[model samples]
Target: MASAVSENPFGRSITTEDIVDTLGFFDSWEDRYKYIIDLGKELPAMPDELKTEDRLIRGCQSQVWLEPSEQDGYFEFQADSDAFIVKGLLGVILSAYNHKRAGEILDFDIDSYFDELDLMRHLSPTRGNGLRAMVQRIREIAGE
Candidate 1:
């Protein structure tokens, strides 16, 4: 069984609230995008072995790998994307859903959360679709 780092790369702990607050601090969308990419940079590396086709997420314009594990009844996910911005998006998704129980994850209003972040409107159609696909994949895993 593989385990992931509890903390993101920056040493400081990251949480969904923290991302929301930080994103709110930036006035321009350009700045926000940069911030998101920075967050992506902070995501820990996924082992090459874990990047198999079975772990590849479909619908993304870039290649994405997701591997999930349950620990003590909570789910933890490890993900990586070939594109910088996509990786950042993965970081955002992980912040919202990681270390949560299946019921909790199911209960989460992801659309509302994305609305609060003002995220979806800015994304390209393909990216938006891919995002939904990733969420759906995670939900399916949790359901199982």
Candidate 2:
């Protein structure tokens, strides 16, 4: 049988640099938020069949699912969220982590990236926690 991971053929072409540059162009947080939501809108829809229980992210306030696979030492993740902002947050995280080599993903300074985006301060405590949870999970997967 073909692996479930093969079913997604997932790709996240956006980069963290693109997000920082775009977010910088916005003069206000509201505009930045709109851009973020738009980014979420661009994410290819994760099919409902892939949104299985084992894929669900545990710490998020909204329902989030992630399907991960490794091919030739690079990781590809297909993820979805029930909330718009959460989806946007997933976009940010995926932009950094998806399709990256395990070493690359593990080496990335995610906190610094978040600081450059000025992200965590703008988020609610719960949301911030969820974002961290997502990162931690991805990092864990990479470490394995």
Worst 10 residues of 1 by lDDT: 1-10
TM-score of each: 0.90, 0.90
Instruction: In angstroms, give how far residue 101 of model 1 lies from its true place.
Output: 0.7
Candidate 2 is scored at a TM of 0.90
**What is the Å distance of residue 44 in model 1 from its true position?**
1.4
Model 2 C-alpha lDDT per residue in residues 1-144, reported as the tens digit of each score:
101111123443778888888999999999999988888888879999999999988899999999888887779888899999999888888888877778788888999999999999999999999999999989999999
Q: How close is candidate 1 to the true structure, as a TM-score?
A: 0.90
> What is the lDDT for 23 in model 2?
97
Model 2 segments more than 4 A misplaced: 1-12
Local lDDT at 80 for model 1: 94
Clashing pairs in 2: none
Distance from true location, Cα of 90 in model 1, Å: 0.4
Query: Model 2 shows how many backbone clashes?
Result: 0
Candidate 2 RMSD computed on C-alpha atoms after optimal superposition onto the true structure = 6.3
